[model samples]
Target: DTAVSQTPKYLVTQMGNDKSIKCEQNLGHDTMYWYKQDSKKFLKIMFSYNNKELIINETVPNRFSPKSPDKAHLNLHINSLELGDSAVYFCASSQVGLNTEAFFGQGTRLTVV
Candidate 1:
């Protein structure tokens, strides 16, 4: 089974629309995160949740929201999407406390026009 999985691997939408991407992990981890990869392939963490509580949040715009329903699930929602939001989104999970290797799901590429 995949350690992490995301739905709608590719998304194409018009500007000003709203969209959501779902993610799940089966690795029994306590921390889940949402990351965005820009065209230059720079990965930046947008939000992180540990044990269903927000632990880390970068300076992402209010348009981006991350929700974690459980320890193994994290979802991202974007409102009034802009062309600048076009990028690849990845979901990752890792155990909390000690340093552990993170597992990433196949990224979801979003294109806004």
Candidate 2:
């Protein structure tokens, strides 16, 4: 079974369009996160949730929103997508305090035209 899984491994959309990526973790982790890897391969955390509670939220644009309905699930929604928004989005999960080691999904590559 996959530890963390994300849907639509590849997404191609035009600017100003809105899209969403779904993620789920079956590792029974308490914390889940959303990360973005830019063209330069710089990985940054966009959002983090622990047990369905918002924990860490980076300085991302308001257009990017993360929702965690439960500890095992976290979804990302992007509004009015821009060309600069093109990147690889990764979904990760961890036990937090016990083990900060995170398991990441294959990632969803979002391309904005």
Candidate 3:
């Protein structure tokens, strides 16, 4: 009975490789988000999706793409992965217009060697 779930909990790859991480939620929420945690342990929002529509944050690099196939799923694809992209990626979900806490996935730690 997981509220949020992400695939490939650990990923290690060479530089310039393309990879994707997937996320899904069973909480019946309308909004979902992707966040990145850097090596220094700082977290930032990378992308957000509401009801299958995209709402990207300006600070995110163009190489990272978030695709929401439906309200319950949001997948992240990174092209030309770089060392700077190595981080713990998290997927979270919250109900629309609610002041409640967002549920997060276990996270996928991506390492570019």
Candidate 4:
């Protein structure tokens, strides 16, 4: 019984390809976010949305895009992917941002060959 689950725990693809990851949460949370964790395990917030409304986008490249069709679901779409984009993508959920604890999914490993 996973609370928040993301499709394709591992993804391998060639460079300059496009990929999409689907995410969903059953915790009834109102806010969700997408984070990137590099090889160094340094985590950073990329995009956040609440109730299908995008609320935060921080220093992320245009190739990465996030879409939330509903409060419990947010999907990631990448265009023209690159080798540098290889990393673990995490989907997280929170009641709210300020001083709130966000639950993270296992993560999807994207490898650009």
Q: Compared to the true structure, candidate 1 yields what TM-score?
A: 0.97
TM-scores for every predicted model: 0.97, 0.97, 0.95, 0.96
For all candidates in order, the CA lDDT equals 0.93, 0.95, 0.92, 0.94
Give the Å shift of residue 17 in candidate 3: 0.5
Alpha carbon deviation, residue 71, candidate 1 (Å) = 1.1
Distance (Å) between predicted and true CA of 16, model 1?
Answer: 0.4
The reply for model 1, stretches above 4 Å from the true place, is none
Model 4 pairs whose backbones collide: none
What are the candidates' C-alpha RMSDs?
A: 0.8, 0.9, 1.0, 1.1
lDDT tens digits by residue: candidate 4, 35-93: 99999999989999999999999989999989998999999999999999999999999
Q: With candidate 4 superimposed using the best TM-score fit, by how many Å does residue 24's alpha carbon deviate from the native? A: 0.2
Model 4: lDDT equals 0.94
Where's the lowest-lDDT run of ten residues in candidate 3? 53-62
- The digit string of per-residue lDDT tens for model 1 on 1-113 reads 88899998999999999999999999999889999999999999999899999988899999998988778889999999999999999999999665688899999999999
Residue 110, candidate 2: Cα error in Å is: 0.3
Instruction: Encode model 2's per-residue lDDT on 1-113: one tens digit a residue.
Output: 99899998999999999999999999999999999999999999999999999899898999998999889999999999999999999999999774479999999999999
